[model samples]
Target: TVDKYGDNSIKLGITNMLIGEYLHTIDNKKRLAVPAKLRDKIGKKAVITRGLDNCLFLYPLKEWEALAEKLSKLPVGQGDTRSFIRLMLAGASEVEMDSLGRILIPDYLKNYAELKKDIVIAGLYNRLEIWDKEKWSLYKENAGRNSEEIAEKLGELGVY
Candidate 1:
């Protein structure tokens, strides 16, 4: 089967699944070093944008393109949809890794996510989510406490 992009669906099945959580530091210049393992999957260029829960989402160029295509097709009449699309698209920035595999986070993005010196880079399948270390810690604690309830809800959705 071919997708709307004319690419074989089977080929799309072979996607890079980013996993694991890594701790790193954002230098004074606002650059964060992409983990060598994660860099291998994300390539040299990517799109970074504001994400839900006060984090930044980093998508490899190809993944970002696919997402953008779908988002573009959403009905503009719906206020929620329009706001969501604007939030993701308007906040997006193209970033290229430097020789040392570091990508600079714009000050605006850093401020939005409250990213300080300590940061957490969490790999979530097709994308990476960058979180402020303190915020991530608090979020993780809350999520862990609710894991059982969350799992039950997902089970209702046939996830389990």
Candidate 2:
């Protein structure tokens, strides 16, 4: 299923190509400006939620809706599915961009990601991931060092 936005960007189900990475800072009020290049693609409103690896995920409304649909279809009898759904949905917050294109990160979400002043907003195809700058640096370093191994693992899944 493809959904077209006013700007003509097409979202094909869970596939939205969000590219580029940006460095930003959280203000005293916990607001961070969305990168200008990404502002339109992410839309005026989005859903923020806890993400893997101690980061936060920002999903455009349409993408979030698709993801929520998938999550809703997870087997209800499975404990792991229930837990994962709770973790993702319970922490979700609907946020709208301010006039300056900034979105306020809730305190709980901030604490969950351990976000301080320095932050990194990274484009991850379908979602934008917000991470503490220092943590992002560390993660990049570690991932870089293990890229070969990671690629090998992914190759098994036909991703290589």
Candidate 3:
């Protein structure tokens, strides 16, 4: 479905992917309203976790299960790998979306992301990244300025 933002999440028969940036707010109780366009794809149940770059990652149940499976197979002998696994798995919380399409953000995660009243829910394929509005704005500005350099690196990796 295309939202007012004109972003499309489904294409070519693929399922469970998302795309868009939605401006929303968390209430005094820390309940976040998931965009209707995204809630269906995200499913009634989701996983919320600490993500990199000080943002929270919200994943659909199926995707999170798949990711957990893959993460379980990584080399446990590597110290960094073990640490990374702990950071992800140990920090994850299974959340159920309410009838109003809301999910409660745990205090730890809210504090971790430094979330204020305003937020930007960015729909990244297979997950949503919740960022504080100001941080998202600054990060977008910096990333926009570096897009050419970033694309060059992706090109080197044969991904651009």
Candidate 1 local lDDT, 1-160, one digit each (tens): 5343332323234455788899999998899999887776787788999999999999988889999999999999999999999989999999998889999999889999999899999999889999999999999999999999999999999997
Backbone clash total, candidate 2: 0
Output candidate 1 Cα RMSD. 4.4
Clashes of each: 0, 0, 0
* Candidate 3 residue spans exceeding 4 A from truth: 1-16
Q: 144, model 2: CA deviation in Å?
A: 1.5
Clashing pairs in 3: none
Q: Estimate each model's TM-score.
A: 0.90, 0.90, 0.89
Residue-level lDDT of model 2, residues 54-87, one tens digit each, is 9999999888989999999889798989999998
Per-model lDDT: 0.89, 0.89, 0.89
Residue 107 CA displacement from its true place in model 3, Å: 0.7
Candidate 1: C-alpha lDDT: 0.89
Error (Å) of candidate 3 at residue 137 is 0.9
